[model samples]
Target chain A: MAQNASQLEHFGRALVDLGLINEELVVLDPDVAASTKVTYFAERFPERFIRIGISEQDMIGVAAGLAASGKTPVACGFAMFVACRSWEQISSSVARPELNVKIVGSHSGLSPNADGDSHQTYGDVAVMRVIPDMKVVVPADAPEAVEALGAIVDTPGPAYLRLARGATPVAYTEGCEFTLGRANVMRDGSDASVIANGVMVPIALEAAGSLAREGISVKVVDMHTVKPLDTDAIVKAAAETGAIVTAEEHSVIGGLGSAVAETLVEKRPTPMERVGIMDRFGESSRSYSALMAKMGLTSDAIEEAVRETMRRK
Target chain B: MLRTINKNQVLILTNIPRVPASITSVLRGISRRHKIPLSTLKRNAQILKEFNLIAYGDPPNFSGVELTELGRFISNLTVGEEPTVHGNMVQTRSGFRPLGTVIKDLRKTVLRMIAEAGSGHLGASLSAVDILAILYMIKMKHDPKNPSWKDRDRFVLSKGHAAPALYAVLSEAGYISPDRLMTLREIGSQLQGHPDMEIPGVDASTGSLGQGLSIGVGMALASKMDGSGSRTYVLLGDGELNEGQIWEAALTAAHHGLDNLTAIVDRNGYQLTGRTEEIKAMDPLADKWRSFGWEAMEADGNDPASILDALNACDLTTGKPSVIIAMTTKGKGISFMEGNKYSRKTPDAQELKRALKELT
Candidate 1:
């Protein structure tokens, strides 16, 4: 098994690799290349890297410009700033034009725990998902993040890549297939299903393991792609399991839970519960794990939500 | 009197086939048969009536237009050929037309289009018409026939409300048919109220303010990286400078040393609602750009000669972006409409007629 690594670092490395293959690949940074770990790409391919300073809006605009000129530009910044501060630029300059620009927003959700609510972004996926022609991807681990980056890079259009700051358990092998908009069934069961993305996928697997010991069968799915959502997988899980629990490291309002619920209410109408931030902001905490535990983003929380959903079912 | 008329007007006159035909029926017949927009037919009909080459049915039972004897003679004379004149301006192919003639026709076309569309930025479009005319007709190295040519220069209309001006210039340059200009802001038309990339010759899609310079910077950067040697030009409104992103883009263009990019601020001194200074002071604008590491220059934005000089001067700069703070009247050409109050107002038919007369 590959050693667990920070998704941000993996993304940086994958970007450099992508630059090696795609000559047109360029990187734009809003003064967070080191924190976002795109410094690796900046160092390797200096000409292709644009240091856009502290202006996230300008970074997106410049990225859109580059994309319009036939270059695939990956704009890297903190999730809070890139996804929120420059939302309109992403909408008007990039998404509306359907340009091939990849916006990699690092330090997503509670991953930037010590930075508190100001830096922690729990609504990146929600804001990005709403833009037309914007593909939203939240990879489960470092390996998956690398794969997701490759997929978005290969696909020609606007896309938002949500990445966590800290390292988590590696969820996939080195060469695991990462098809965009297709969910991966991590573990299968019969009673209910736990659909999760980003940092919550591994926790969901752990929760399914605990449920297995209790003989309460549960299915764990890694729904990495938030937009162009795998509605087929969601509907099948809802129909086959009859109950669903959505887990993510974001707000329950417009993140994975809301997405799954929206799909179910329209397609299958299954009983469900959401395990995520309860529409509130994050604050400073001791560590990443402590913040996750404090925010009810763990195996225990997912297990409880799954059981509650099954009881309703 | 061999008055100027475009090929479309010629088509309308010759296609009448008979006198005493209702203007509506003649327009519908020509529109359906030739796939011309009814709006174009209607506007051309009005123009024909104004020139005394056609007469509409009398009021109370007015229905359509009929070509007068003069209209018949002129149409017969110009059959199977381009119109020899377009509103007192000698008509010629896009690249070959004189700058003055192009600017005059573009101004008239812009007013007529806005009047037909019923709503648009008349003042802003008129203010930028000469600048757009100079760029498309003389300065910018672009191919209307091959708009997507990789090595061709690029233009981004950042002040997108001025789309009427850009569309007029584009049609004059042969990027779009003159008839398509009537479809401005109509549903399903390529000529949107704001510039969209779906329109041929529009390099970057822009509408929201202050975003075009960055797009221009990106295109310039890409051109530099690929060694394409293509230049990029962006037209921004002075009022649009209130947007912070424009400054952000300003710093970016200079930081990258993008000498191939040029930004022309159509300094008409007003935005919608009021004069730009009263709304938000942007004095020492040229100094502000120079402080941001750009080669700032000024020109009489509404003058074809001055605009040509400024655009030519941009090519002399090295290792830095260039900006031309083109000073211009808000609603240029027409005497009454040349100010802030007319910023977004579409002209009535009477106002359009007066404006066209001023242009001629």
Candidate 2:
């Protein structure tokens, strides 16, 4: 974690690089180019860029149309608006046809901290996951974000890649192999397991370290791809570690926590606690840290949830 | 699906208000078929005259009411006869037998399919027949043999309820076989209740209103980016204009200066419930489009030659999108269905037979 990096920035750069190599690659934005960091690509390849201007539903439809025309369209916009406002379009136009449109929803969760509740998205992950044939991915850090972009580019059909607005600690080193529908194990412990994704991954890793110093060994798993939840990893974490705690920057209702709980309940039935935003809207905060701390979305929250789950075990 | 608008609401009727002998014959035919009293038929004919649906014409004792130009236009659709046009055929890769003839045939096919499907949108589909026929047969740069050709012009039926018209035109164009028209709205059929791209010649799958414009804008943008001389056309219903997304896409197309995009609105003035003016007054539609930075024009939607003229008048290099506000009757050809309460419903066996006979 020498320098903080943004997953959205990494996504923009990776998409631009992919566009340069892949002639079919095209980017569509809904007036959040600079904020979503898609402006990086827009500046480099002006011809390949389409600025749709503040219409998420229209952007989704356009992207679907482009995909139908044999162009790989990456529709970029804020996570909250793109997922909620145009959920019907995504479902009907893109996913229903199984179009090769990649939806990149930036500023996911509480990342747009100072912008307040309307800007913060706690339900995007849930919304995208439920769409049929939609592949959902939330990268833990910059490197993982780039890898996820590459993976989706190679794959066909509709995929949603969630990216955060603010700078986050770099978790994976360069050349990290990203596999779709697979979890990355950052730490190994038998006492309890902390499964996390997106902005919460580094926090979960820190929580595991803090727990280790207290002689409570903890396992940290990055369940990056949310849709096809890595059942094998979760089952193993429950069977071996005996306890599980799921963390995310999204709402506790239907994001990573819900996905993990659904998997564990049907597979191994382990004691678990979710460390994410409660079922409520976010408010204006001074900073990302303040929002996370206020919402109980910190490493301390993960550690507490881990301890509570371990006690239940 | 039709509900009458306020009878007091003054609408500009396109037909002359006199009853002619031929129209009286049709009314007499209806009276004889339904066993209704001639006095009752005459009273109803007066009501129809109040709406300017028929005009008076004389040949003494044997004279019946005569259908007006508008009435004749609608009646001819039921029997499948092309309206005569002065213009010669405009050449395109897809063969054409004069657009008027093509539209009449397409309208007949649309009505028959609606009757066969047991339930389909009659008014909306018939209203948009000429617009779809002209685009498919003449205006578009499409090849039915190679429906997916990269440079082929695209048409998206944004008002998906009018899918029967698109299916009819697509089938006639050879993108689909005429035999498959019977499978419309059937399970496992490509011809769904709405337009599905799975059906050939349909550029985008659009049933939800206010969405096809955006998809068309997207395709137009793609064509511009690809430097391909392809244009994208989106056919919308006047009722479908109530959806805010249409305006959103409208603004996007204007903002992008997408000259390759054209939106043809079937301004038939009717929605599922009633007159669009009553549901939501979209009067001054051309001005609204003009204010949105589009080159807006109006034409007779049911007339293929007029529609073709308006479409040909569009200048793509002007750096603005074009929209043709086609004024049309809800059910252009069928006398009973035109502006009837059940304009959106399926035609019954008796009505279908009478309609086919009236086409001539």
Candidate 3:
């Protein structure tokens, strides 16, 4: 509602842009200055942002109290600390009450390459998905990041937003319509459905083009909303194409791949292979790309996985 | 102003927010079965007004409701004695037991529950036990029958490692099944090593220290904004005070004049490894709080009578947030563990027995 866009780029900037700011808008996080990118907002509008400082578990409860106090608190923290260290609080404090709190996690899904396993969160989405009332969002790129930020802030319930280390391509045009609970179709092909999100999204699209030239048609779907799991799109793809391959920068188990498989099997069984880090921790000695490659997340690897699953179909 | 209750419904109502169901149906049955004039029933409503079941006044609008720091203290007072929203009490005030008996029972039950579970932060639990006991049995105005009641005061155990005392109080207050107390830390029990709000009577899920106080601040601020006259109480451990976030909350409480917000620093001087002084010194503690603009009090945290009196006396501080630096003995009552530092060594049979003898 403010005239200036700079002031509008506040802690609740995304919500303000979407004209979705409400009385329930509460933003909370621990003391990581640069990671959340909330410092810009804090310096500008200090009242809206609550600095909890290095306490993920406490943030959940505090956010819950704010929620109970009739303000919506968007609780945020680092991916590994929240996804792993503070699950009990997340489960009991925010989710159990089904309080209207948004849990926005920065450094999500192996994006913390500068830091190792302690920081490179592999199972954030998976862990969040297990909690009831948790709607998980893994936005594809920077544009999707902005869009997802707007959508999730106004989503009106307990939710988790998985943000990367700003390691995303600007996928969508400056302003394209986006909402939660739906998947975006980047490419249409009948050969196989290569469902991907976060860092793997651009890679999925590139692989789709490369496979197209090689006479292997791969349909790339951006499965950003991981929890309400986009069953209709995935079911349609599985039933029609008969082959599906899922990729994410997370662990193979209980993540995007696992969520997709869970849907496909319950609706229509499709030949599938999950493309992500096979149950293993990342090492400090490897580059991000090398880690991705070693963990079988390369474009060629995804294309090959797609082709192999199609052959099974 | 204690807003007027529904005059018509007050013919038979209870608890201010609830109506006596049996009376409601009988009145309804008379109107429906006997074809009594509805306007005649309005006469009964007038009778309720005469009986003070409902205050005789013009109805107030929602706009009249507003939150203030003073409103927090207003909600905790005995009826008819309140400075605002004055309500006439229908009955004389009920009496509470002597504070000494209350403290004795609270300590016995809390330590026994933890000792039975075989795994708990004994020192932290004992340190915070008196504060928890005072809040529940004396200071806080809440309905144990309705733990999630919207208008009730909120208490956050920021140092949640001391969940044993919290669980015991919740059980004794009838918010949870007492049988569940023995099942703490069991695979499927709601009682974990730390407090989880999923369990009844817990306001927040907290195990990680220092953060619960911030949550308390948010709750207090929100309550003030919404015009909800509910106070917030947060208990932080002496060791937990080592966290920088605790200072953030402490400073904010006073800067904002969250006078309804009260905190108890459980200064038993022990952390997980040793004395907090050995781990990190946070002395000159009361002076620090006073400088932060809080009217701070130092209490014998082990004395529930002192705790009860000190907490009620908080409102007298005037226009500032209050904190009771509750000086306590770690592992109090348990002779072998009392006045000693923490050891990472898990208590074995001998230690447990010694603790049990003193606690029992």
Q: Which number leads on lDDT?
A: 1
Worst 10 residues of 2 chain B by lDDT: B8-17
Candidates in order, interface RMSD in Å: 0.7, 1.1, 3.7
Q: Write the per-residue lDDT of candidate 1 for residues B39-124, one digit (tens) a residue.
A: 99889888888998888765787854655657645654453133332221222243234457778888899998989889999999
* lDDT, candidate 2, B171-273, per-residue tens: 8777788889999888899999988778878888888888888888888888988898788889888989999889989999999898889898899888888
List, residue by residue over B1-360, the lDDT tens digit for candidate 3.
Answer: 334433333222322212112333444544564466666655664555454444323345212111123333332333213232112211111222333455555567666676677777776776677678657654565766677787788998888888888887777555778778889888899998888778978887778666777678778878776678678888888888888767767766665678878888888887777778888988888998999898888888886556655686776766778999888998776666675542222466666666656654
lDDT of 3 at B168: 78
DockQ of 3: 0.26
> 1 or 3, which is superior by DockQ?
1
Runs in model 1 deviating more than 4 A are A1-3, B1-95
Among these predictions, the greatest TM-score belongs to 1
Error of model 2, residue A252, in angstroms: 1.3
Lowest-sum lDDT 10-residue window in model 2 chain A: A1-10
Cα lDDT for residue A96, model 2? 77
CA shift of B223, model 3, Å: 2.0
Better of 2 and 3 by TM-score: 2
lDDT of every model, 2 decimals: 0.86, 0.81, 0.70
Top candidate, metric DockQ? 1
Clashes in predicted model 3 = 10
